[model samples]
Target: MDALLSLSNDLAAAVERVRGAVVAVNARPRLPSTGVHWRPGIIVTADHTVRSDEDITIIAPDGRTVAASLVARDPGTDLAVLRVHDTDLPLADLGDPGSLKVGHIVLAVGHGPRVSWGVVSALGGRWRTWRGGEIDQLMRLDLTLYPGFSGGPLVDVKGRVVGINTSGLSRQLELAIPVSTVTRVADELIDKGHVSRGFLGVGLQPARLPEAFRRRLTGASEIGLLVVNVQPDGPAAKAGVLLGDVLVALDGAPVGATEDVQAVVGARRAGSTVTATILRAGAPAEVSMTVGERPSRRR
Candidate 1:
């Protein structure tokens, strides 16, 4: 009975410690404001949490509420950072997401007053958002997350944040982007004011070149992405990339699949030029294209 009491006390203390750093951010869209302690008086949340509004507040540890502003946001990863004018607020310690492994025990903290238990289900899980047509690597957890849980913290046993709870696929499957990915993109957003990524204005399809075409094309592959249509006056069109051209490589890396091209361009900075090798008219040729801004629809 004494040991049970002691363990209960320890658990209570741990919850208190996390709650101290956890804050209820009164953001638009009503997502659960799990808290973040990145810097003095600074907190991080999901980009979608505060993207559509201006007035925001952070519910502090001592039951104090303060106004805050959206510091930065990266739409690609759906992460955002917030800053409070006051400097005395407690900050949460960020854990290295690389340390997270599948089957590791995790605690999902949200605005409600308790930490929920779950286990990491998958790593490097890729999926596309309903709004943004891009692939984001996600960490799946075995928790039945709620709507307000978006942007909350996924902590380890020690109460260190390993990832930010982003979205859910089912009642039992929760998803999050690793904190390391958020940190990387957040750093860029802090410095550049936006997530810069390369874009090629062309819709592609997988195809096999005819035997005669393959014979003349040195780099043509029967199992690579082929350009079905190029957007008029867009990056690929401006670079003289024509329809039916087979994309062989980008920046010296082979692109065998449609996702490969998307991944390469999606990771590149906008306005930067990249070399693309293409099989055009049964001949291998190189083209230079300035990565353009992707349209909001991603079409």
Candidate 2:
């Protein structure tokens, strides 16, 4: 009985370490407390958790409840920000989600029926929401969660938060959008009230050059981005980037994948002009285009 008691005490201590960082978000009609908290001062949570409600009330571990306001959120990434009264609070240590690997021992911290424990079951699983939007860089966990745990923390054994408990996939598959993504966008949301992303207005797909085409061309692999569609009045259209065009490079750098183009374009600001090199038919060419701002998701 003493040995079992010791083990229980040790597990309780681990939960207590991260409990201060876990908060309950009570937005009246939404739910009594939809587990949310300030990472010191920066409030983070799942987008869908607070989308339907207003006037959020944040409850601390010691039973202190304070009013919090929604700052900004992106449904695409399942991330949101909240601002509460200025107070010194304990913050969780943020980790690099890009560094997480499968089979790593991770903890899911939430206000479950009671608190619970779990591990990362998988990684790099892609998911789409009800709105037909795709979520990137999702970490899967083997934990059970509900409305109260939507915005809780997923900490490492060291108690450092590695991801935000965003959503659950199945009975055994839980998902957390990386904490890095939330932190990055949170800065933009707080300072600018919105995330300013550049848009190219072109749908691209990965295509590998056929061996025959690769042999005729002196380039590696023949892999390139095939323009599937160009928005009617978008930056790509205004710049004369048409359908069937093969994107090869951006700003003099080789574009090896669709993500490369997304990175280059997503990094630019609206009204910023960039040079895109394309392989048209059998000829190499470039087009100068000005990027445009993506539409704000806030109503």
Most TM-score-accurate candidate: 1
What C-alpha lDDT does candidate 2 achieve relative to the native structure? 0.71
Give per-model TM-scores.
Answer: 0.77, 0.70
Give the Cα error of residue 60 in candidate 2, in Å: 1.9
Worst 10 residues of 1 by lDDT: 127-136
The total of clashing pairs for model 1 equals 2
> Candidate 2, which ten residues in sequence have the lowest lDDT sum?
126-135
Clashing pairs in 1: 32-148, 37-92
Give the per-residue lDDT of model 2 (tens digit) for 8-105: 66656656777776777775464643454545566787777774546677877677877888877766566778888774557766666667777776
**What TM-score does structure 2 among the candidates reach?**
0.70
lDDT of each: 0.72, 0.71
Q: Could you tell me how far off, in angstroms, the CA of residue 136 lies in candidate 1 after the best superposition?
A: 8.1
Residue-wise lDDT of candidate 1 within 1-299, one digit each (tens)? 99889755655555666666677778875554655766676677777667455788877767778888876776656777787886575567678877888998777887655567778988875555543334446688887566567777887767787777866332355777776676776676667666666689999988766787656645545665689999999999999998888887787776778877877787667788889988777677889999997654321
